[model samples]
Target: MDGLFTYNPAMVKAALGTHMVTGYAEDTFITIEEISQGTTSKTGCDGETVRSVDPNTRFSVKLTLQMGSPTHKYLLNRYNRDKKDGNGSFPILINDLTGKEKFSAINAWVTKLPTNTKGKEGQNKEWTLETGQADFQIE
Candidate 1:
């Protein structure tokens, strides 16, 4: 069961790049230019307004799991400081569905080998997968 929780690295990269700018905001989209270990580029939208949030933003990959579960979910989070800078840390909030579960002792941590890519128009898109677990459990 522990090994069953593994993630597809390519999928993680693509999903992170896609969501880097758009976030969880409604009707928002991100135009990803590049994605690498600690860097990303994207066009961000705040409603009808579009602006660039690039270069200054750093992305880190993470895996989250409930204390007693064998499954884990991958997360891509942004920050203003490098991991070595030791100046900033931010929580990556679970989306609306998981937030409602109120799971106990869920933990999140960094993932290895985060990838990078150059921006390609029309290539930016979101991909989500349904886990085998019940909707309320960490999947």
Candidate 2:
């Protein structure tokens, strides 16, 4: 479909920073890395290559604290749209930080945005942190 879509890693990072559930702040300097995308195909009757309807994008971010607490890690994912639907939304997943471990548990948190809101001409739109659970285990 022909629609505007944007993914600001900065904004995603900011969202994670403001997330108190992680018990960390933006100053913590979390490192985010992209993992992989569509690289496989389904079984086909012919040798023709089949494209994935929704390509996947994965991210891994690490957060270390000065305290003796374990380091925190998060995994984020974004899937591309297969078909254009006015009611379709983007999906976001989050993994909380635990002990010195490098990655959080899978499916720690997940949410979706049905539609994006528009702001005044030059002003930026604000994102609301009104979903998912919030708690800190890394001290």
Provide the overall lDDT of each model, using Cα atoms, as 2-decimal numbers.
0.27, 0.32
Question: Highest lDDT among the candidates is held by which one?
Answer: 2
Measured against the true structure, the TM-scores of the candidates, in listed sequence, are 0.24, 0.24
In candidate 2, what are the lDDT values of residues 1-139, reduced to their tens digit? 8866553323432233333323333353444444445365676778777766434344443443322222222212221221233322222334333222132322222223223334553222112212222222232
TM-score of 2: 0.24
Cα error, candidate 1, residue 64 (Å): 15
Estimate the Cα RMSD of every predicted model relative to the unseen true structure.
19.8, 18.8
Clashing pairs in 1: 33-118, 33-119, 34-117, 35-116, 35-117, 36-116
Task: Give one digit per residue, the lDDT tens place, for model 1 in 1-139.
Answer: 5644443222221122223212221232212221323333445475454444443222322232222221212232222232446432233332323223211112223333224323542222232221111112334
Q: Model 1: runs farther than 4 Å from truth?
A: 1-80, 97-99, 102-114, 125-139
